[model samples]
Target: MKMIDLTGTTGVIFGVANHRSLAWAIAEQLGQAGARLAFSYQGERLKENVAMLAAKLPGSIIFECDVTDDDAMARGFAEIGTAFGHLDYLVHSVAFARKEDLEGTFRDTSRDGYRLALEISAYSLLPMARLAAP
Candidate 1:
């Protein structure tokens, strides 16, 4: 059998909420390709979820990181670098929207709600990229 070589490749997956998440799916594919895994979660609740999901992927490192916090994001990436020295790929599946915003019309969305959604769903990716960039 021919195997894909990922001998030195390291992958960091951000925003894995549960087993059914897109992040989890990507992590699975990366694992299949022999990439080492590191995972980040938003909070304590999600930290537990990520840890559970990561257990199936051997040698995976899981960390708590809220993308909205620059310090937390920086520390997370720094920790990953400390652990792995270098990284080859970073997968971002982070997105957020309030339940009301998702269910109701855009006209009904409050200004704060819109800002929150954009900040979490769209803007978070920029810093994540900057910090994780090789």
Candidate 2:
């Protein structure tokens, strides 16, 4: 059997906030397979975590990308494309939910919380796909 070769492929990993995050795990797998990587964080706190993880993978680039913002998302993909030229894969492992909604009845959830959750968790994927598409 021929081993699948991933060398020279570029992969962008979004939503890696900590060492234990799924995005981090996917990045490790992609890196081991010889894919060049880029990572995005939601904020400063997450950026710190992503930076620490990126340190383990020399040459990996990290960016601050709040998926809810169109400009930030556009800038992130533009920077990645400019830096890497092309991307072969994009991993979206980010999700958000208000603490109250995580443990309470749906009836208790506020309208704003519900809207925010859908925007961040569901709608975010659409923009990522659009930006990453060839």
Candidate 3:
């Protein structure tokens, strides 16, 4: 069978919670196609985990990023640029909200909860795109 070929593509993906996550799954296929993939995560623990898992995919890399932190975001993209020079695509499936906001009544959601969700889930895309764009 002929393999899918994306040999020159460099991609950045966010929100890969695990090997089974949508982002990881997409990245895995992209890697199979010979594309280079860079993944972003929010914490130390996740970085360690993704580092191990992403290693199985060809040319895959992990970047530490917390969408809530501007410095981390800037540094993460800058690092990716240093490694790949340019980016061909981005897969962003990130979302965050408090347990209460997601499980309890909408009326009970805190102001901070709403702000945090919007900032991380909705507003972060622009900057991520801007930094990663070729």
Candidate 4:
């Protein structure tokens, strides 16, 4: 198949947890397409893994961006903008639910747990879109 020529395009990817992550696969495809990439990991624990994968792609960079924190997301997008000058796209492949919350029926999930799941899984995209917009 002819590779999509993404030369000169720039993008940020969120949720590359490890080499096996679907996000990592997407990043690899984007890299192969010639798009420059920046990866955002949720916490320090994930930083090393993301950095390692990003290093394999020329000109790729990684940043810490906990989606639960607005400040961190803002800073991360700012860093991406500064690094790439512009964004052509963004890939969001992150989602989370507490272990306990996942164990029981949906009705058994606590209010806080439900809120946390939605905040991380769904609501995060809104701020990310707004920040990445500019």
Candidate 5:
């Protein structure tokens, strides 16, 4: 068997809530493959947890980025650019819906909740992709 050697690869993973998050699993695998990684956490509450997980992988960094906030997204990507110069890949595992919105069928969801979900889960990729393009 051979291990994938991604020694010079650089990337970021979004939406890591904890060790159990699928995004975290991706991060671990990427790390094992020798990809340098940066993780984007949503808020201060998750900072400690994300930081702890990132520490397990050498050279990993954690930054705050709220997909709903364009300014924050810009700043977070800027930080990553400043740190890594360029990105080789991105992992977007972010998805969200209000708890109430998940209670019933999609048709029963409130307009605001649906919009929020779309913005966080789908629209966020656009700007992040643009930033990572260079």
Candidate 6:
């Protein structure tokens, strides 16, 4: 079988929460194409699982990044730069929602619930892109 060469391509993927996650699925494909990958997860609880997935790819690194937090995003991308020196691609498969917001009427959703959902699901991408951009 012929494999695509992504030998010099570097990328950071955000929001790989589990093995079944979209990020993980894309990561598996990227690895098979010989891409250098860095994975950023939202919480420490997911660190082990993310690390395990990262181990499957050659020269992959796992770092903690809460997309809503300024410091964490900054630190994580800094570490990525130090590790890979540059970024060639980025993927955003991160999202979050309250059960009330998702399962029921939208009018009944709380303000904090809307904020939290937007923060994790949408606004988080801006900082990630900024930091990952060279």
Worst 10-residue lDDT window, candidate 6: 1-10
Per lDDT, the best of the predicted structures is: 4
Residues 54-134 of candidate 4 have per-residue lDDT tens digits of 999999999998899999998998898899999989999988999999996989999999999999989999998998885
Give residue 33's error in model 1 in angstroms: 1.2
Report the number of clashing residue pairs per model.
0, 0, 0, 0, 0, 0
lDDT of 3 at 29: 82
lDDT of 6 by residue, 61-133 (tens): 9888888789988998888889989889988999888777787788888899999999988998888778777
lDDT against the true structure, per candidate, is: 0.86, 0.87, 0.85, 0.92, 0.91, 0.87
Off by over 4 Å in 3: none
**Residue 42 error, candidate 4, Å:** 1.5
| lDDT, candidate 1, 1-134, per-residue tens | 32676756898998789989998998987877777889998877777888988888877898888887999989999989988888888887888988888787889988888999888888988998898887
lDDT of 3 by residue, 1-134 (tens): 42788988898889887877877788888888888988898888788768877888877889889987878989988888888888898888898897878987898889999998999998999888777765
Give candidate 5 regions above 4 Å deviation.
Answer: none
Candidate 2 minimal-lDDT segment of 10 residues: 1-10
Clashing pairs in 6: none
What is the RMSD, in Å, between candidate 4 and the native fold over all Cα?
1.2
lDDT minimum window of 10 residues, candidate 5: 1-10
Clashing pairs in 4: none
- Between candidates 2 and 5, which one is better according to TM-score? 5
Q: Which ranges of candidate 6 are over 4 A from the true structure? A: none
Evaluated against the true structure, the overall lDDT of model 5 is 0.91
lDDT for model 3, please. 0.85
Q: Estimate each model's TM-score.
A: 0.92, 0.91, 0.90, 0.94, 0.94, 0.90
